[model samples]
Target: MPTILHRRWLVGGAALLILLALTAGYIFLTTAATAPARARIQAAASMRPFGEVDQEVVNARTLVEDTPESARAWSVLGLAYLQLARETADPTNYGRADEAFQRALDLDAASVDALIGAGTLALARHEFAEALELGTRAMELNPTIPRVYGVIADAQVELGRYEEAVASVQTMVDLRPDLASYSRVAYLREIHGDNQGAIDALELAVSAGGPAAENTEYVRVQLGHLYFATGDLARAEQIYGESLARLPEYIPALDGLARVRAARGEYSEAIELYEQASARIPLPGTIIALGETYEAAGDQGRATDEYQLVEAIQLLFEANGVRSDVELAAFSAAHGDDADRALALARDAHVRLPTIFAADVLAWSLYRTGAIAEAAGVADEALRLGTQNSVMLYHGGVIAAADGDTDTARTRLEAALDLNPRFSPLLADRAAAALAALDN
Candidate 1:
């Protein structure tokens, strides 16, 4: 009886040992299966919004090669490439982003996120037609998706369909109510002569909360521009200062602030800002601002240097197959009386662009050269565009007065004053004098 009891105990011990071994094997297999997924998740979490995350995402792309079916991996790749494109502005980065987005689309053809990214790339390239098509298709594929409408709105705006752009942006606001959409709507309103509407839209944009840090800074800069355009120089200065506080190197804000200072007759302050902006982006606009400010400060030599720099920039753009006729004409007209070189440039530029503003410049340049009859014809063409721009109206008034058409000159000059009495004190004073002479 003792032997039989000992054998039963041994059998039970063996069974318990087998059960323990099986449980250990199951745990090992489960952990091994989950290890790769955990690694992928960790890698994704390490990706930042706009910095080193771009490189990390590129590295993650290699790891996901074996997991081509991973939709989330493709999505991460797309986002990383998009951010890289935004930071670098290298069109090649946009091309890479497009491939990444295409990969995401391949993984999930109905991916609204991928569609939006692709659409944004098209928009950035100024391929407005393609952007509109892609954005519309994306929206049709998924109406509830965010940001697609914003892309469409931007495309429409570039195409000069302002009303349609506004409607599309409004829909985006209803769908996502984000800052990007709101800001775009504000720009459209501002262009449509609704300053108050622009301010209201921008205020909503400020409150909309979804703006990324860079986007928030940009929106503030845009607000400064809106204020400047509406003649609120003080408010413009304040907004630009706020943006510079957030992003000290923001060129657009710096330029706007400089313009405000120049308008307020603070030439020294304006020059400093213009120099900073010029160092960053030596475009024609910045150079012209700097030249004008220097001239205002009675620094003739410095102003000449700035104008020469502008001429060099124009030559560079022309070499690159990008025309700056309008800018050249305006520059020429501004300094034609004192610079023979400027008058020659104005005539050539006016012949190229042939826009109303260009015509006005050509007319002014001709008038400086004692070519009143030629100036009169070009000025008449300029008025035919019916822009109602105060500067253009003032130019028409000047041309009419030069041609001895007192009635027409008074009409145009009065129109210019009614549009903006403070358009330019010099121009306004001239208009007032011309009208007084007509009355006499």
Candidate 2:
């Protein structure tokens, strides 16, 4: 037990012990401002593959060319590009989307689709203020639109307005019970500590969004993730396999399957799956997981190699005008020994998003920086949702212990183990050791 509870992060074992208390909370997204809107358009955040949804884009383009002044067609094109941007993780697609949406607005100053499209793009780009403005305006223009509620809900959660988010999603579901509404409901349910409710809602979404293409594959992977979080590896694996069966080489499903492998102590297999996932996405998180699993298997050299890739990726993302603070903060916190760097990255991330994920990293980073008092406050905030994140609980527990709150510390550490004892090969043992010390 040491500073930041890395199992080996040994700046101050005594301080880590003292900080090992307190817990509970959710993991909600962050953005700001609230606008209520209602209109009759299906949720458009499917984020399908470019090839699969290229037809819609082409059709929209054709319509615009044939009818140059058609705001509807222009809005459709904008939305298409927005989805493409998300699917491809390409920033340029956002610019194209913005242009199309602006054209729609120019042609029809009051086009609700254009407004919603713009708002969606803003949400994607982390422009919470603009997203809120557009969401509110779209709502006023068409109060019955379900997608408006989604946009409003996303914005509200980012702004730390959980109450409004709940109400917005409620209105969305009440309007129509579809894939989008149900998925939001599921995430909100998880945030509220209703794992079963979240699972049930996703089940509904899976059933509602069948046919096994992009949407179904994505939902199934998410369902697998929930299952993994709850320590149901068998069911999670089944879901992931089914998803992969539907969409061979689906990266998310591959990642989920890899996680299941890691949990089951299938180290080599896990590494293979994770490597495949890395080949597919090259996301920092995937690389970090690969390294962590390698560490779990005692492959220290390989782990170091993977950890080194993080800085290069960060540099690349920066060069492309993408900060990606959340992932960077997480990567630094997990892999870097310099607590100062982790704290700096986490502080910036919290300022940018303020989501529970950011809050958790900030709390841990504060702990790493020896700001035990500050860490306690942010750790408390991180647990505001009663989330089942074992790492978050472990951090809160350790912080509480450091603060001399033995009861709170014990409870949190116990909860972390109960939620998922194997959450981190590194931290799980540390959590166990901390609990044993508390017992002594």
Candidate 3:
């Protein structure tokens, strides 16, 4: 492995090259009409922060207030809002981002910055098609910009266009192999069942680093998740712990440590960690994790309360025009909340996105509602990408068993266990029991 100093030197050189390339792209793409606003916004992007990007939001908002007619100013505000949303796990920022981006587009429909910002917001809201469209438009306007390809690749991946996503990610990394592009590479590698390759790419991303501590820690948490997913609990815990040590109570690191604790059967510790995360930000995923930890610890009442909080957050998300159907469908099906509603949400999500994850949730919901054959078919769709996600495998295994495909059930269940025996505190044991029953 290269030393951290060596990696930093390489990244610094590459960043210099990227800066020159981006400068050229900006010159070529910027018109006299938008040049001033665009230059100011791009300059603001270079302001390094200690641990948060909220300062960017403040700066952009001030700029927009001063120059209300500047489309680029509004676009940067939208982008900043999106960044704040990611850091805080506050879905309400989605609404602010949408409004700001829309205003930018209303002022200048051809603004590439606004288009990319809207695309990112759409991606966050699970509107894969819209994200793809906006990203494509941005690329057409300014193909030299590397980050546009990140948006395109992300949307392509979610839309199940794996080959296109791969090509886009390749182009991105070739243009600028920084944290953003390298992370995309890692994701594509992971979905192709190449865990080690993914880890290698993510390590490179970490070395490339980011302008904000949150950015680096966010990638670190993802690295930890990959380790945890592959059953390297100790490494995952170490990574999460180190991240939390560097940035006290970072929500993603806290959640990761909680997961590691739960996997190790330290339910009390897991519960405490998750509660801390939830208190910091009532993100649906954190709430769901807290609920599941409670369920694992035999605290049904608290678990139910946490689950209800998730429902309330979902409602808030919907009111903000952010879609949560796929997530809600999977959660409802898993918890036996509302079979009909879950199935409906799953179908709607699949119709809108048709992603592998949506397919998995649809399959799970169908199975929960007793549509065994249909569920099996959808489960196959979910596995079509050969992604090595253990939860999807577990769902596939159970659905196959229900559909009377004993061989497939055994194979998928075995694969899930082999990949990660402790994939989920709530479901891993159930998967093992099902596999044992099949053997019997």
Candidate 4:
């Protein structure tokens, strides 16, 4: 087998004159009144450049300073910190966010905004059960709040509670058919193999988002991803280019474009983009992608360094109480010396919550450890939603082939190659070889 590298706004207005300025101020005040402080925070946090994120953090801090007893101000500060953390990939910001959320709760224990913020932070930390509990409580506090449903839906999705997630997201879209709601719908549809439906939802998401906001660019990238999954590389490339035009530093867009380049066998161009993407967001996945590119180019030393970087980052995350279970398990299954340890870690991760991603790792690990029957079961879970991921299908196909499921293996491997012929330099070559063997 060959290598595997598949990865995955606010407006401000100025007043014309003093009266115009006052009128704008009055408008903001009235809007804030109806929108709630958290909504306003979310809007500001989602839109514009990092300048706006910084400004919001400052503004929230000032508000809390002026009114220490105001739970809303504290919650707003917490959310701004969280947003900053997301943009910068700085885990320290999460600590600051934690304090801000707790402070908000201290001021007002039943504050739904604070609860939701905390829940979201938990989700980021991969504490799915905790996130769900916090989300559930926040929902009980206010059922009509759209964002609360989103938090709960996200938690459910991570926990493999797809039916519940679908129901929750339906309510979310019904209440507010905006970017957040439409994006969630897009992903659910994609997972369910409804490619057309996914594309339709993402288009709505793009339309619902304002140009000034980064969310608009984000949705554009999602639309590109749907196109990519359908093997429409030209459309995917076009959409990704559009997204980068608006949000030049968006890591996901950079990574998506990098993958597109790699799939076309543009190794040098792919390497350049992957480097830029990894520098901005050195997550395990991005690093892994970079490693695959290096390996494809026969730069074994650099590839080894990238793998070490992933391990170091995983350790750092674990130390910070952030569970990197899926990444850790996947990495171990692929690279760990001890097959038993790899299988155990994967199994443990799956037991916590069988996310489709976790299930894929578990299947790979089980196969590695020669637990063929269990691997088959785990593979079923991985493909349950019909996710069109080349690496996942490749792994599943190889596993099934080892277990004497030639028919299933051929179907999956063929689908992977059809989806993206150059999905992984190693895996693609491997898939072709496997299919040839099965035919013989």
lDDT of 3 by residue, 255-285 (tens): 9999999998999999999987766655667
> Tens-digit lDDT track for model 2 on 1-440?
12111112111000000100000011111222101000000111233344766776788889889989899989989977765554444445677888999999999988999998888777665566678889899999998988787788777776667778777777776777777777777777777776766777777777777332666667767788888888788899999999888878777788888888887789899999988766645555677889989999999999987787655555544544554666679878877889898999999989878888889999988988889899989999999988877888899999988878899899999998887777776788899999888878
- Residue ranges of candidate 2 with Cα displaced over 4 Å: 1-50, 210-212
TM-score of 2: 0.84
Model 4 per-residue lDDT tens digits across residues 1-440: 11001001111110000010000001112222233322323443445454677888999999999999999999999988877766655566777888999999998989999999999888777777888999899999899988888788888888899888877877786677777777777777667766676777777778777423555776677788778877888888898898888877677789789878877878899899998876655556677888888888889899888777666555545544557677688888886778998888898999997889899999999988888988988898899888888888898898889889999999999998888777675578888888899978
For residues 1-440, could you state the per-residue lDDT of candidate 1 as single tens digits? 32101212110000000000000001111134344323332343344244554665667587568677876667667666665544333234555666777888888887777777777766554455787888898899988765777778776755545557656765665566557666665665554445556666666666664334556666766677666655777888898888888767666688888888776777899899998776644445676778878887889899888777565544433433433445666776775345556567777765544545567787878777778788888888777734555667788887888898878888888887775554442355666777678777
Candidate 1 stretches greater than 4 Å from native? 1-92, 95-99, 102-110, 281-284, 295-440
Where is model 4 more than 4 Å wrong at Cα?
1-50, 210-212
Counting clashing residue pairs in each candidate, in order, gives 0, 32, 0, 6
Per lDDT, what order, best first?
A: 3, 4, 2, 1
Worst 10 residues of 4 by lDDT: 16-25
Q: List the residue pairs that clash in candidate 1.
A: none
- Per-candidate TM vs. native? 0.62, 0.84, 0.85, 0.86
Candidate 4 similarity to native, TM-score: 0.86
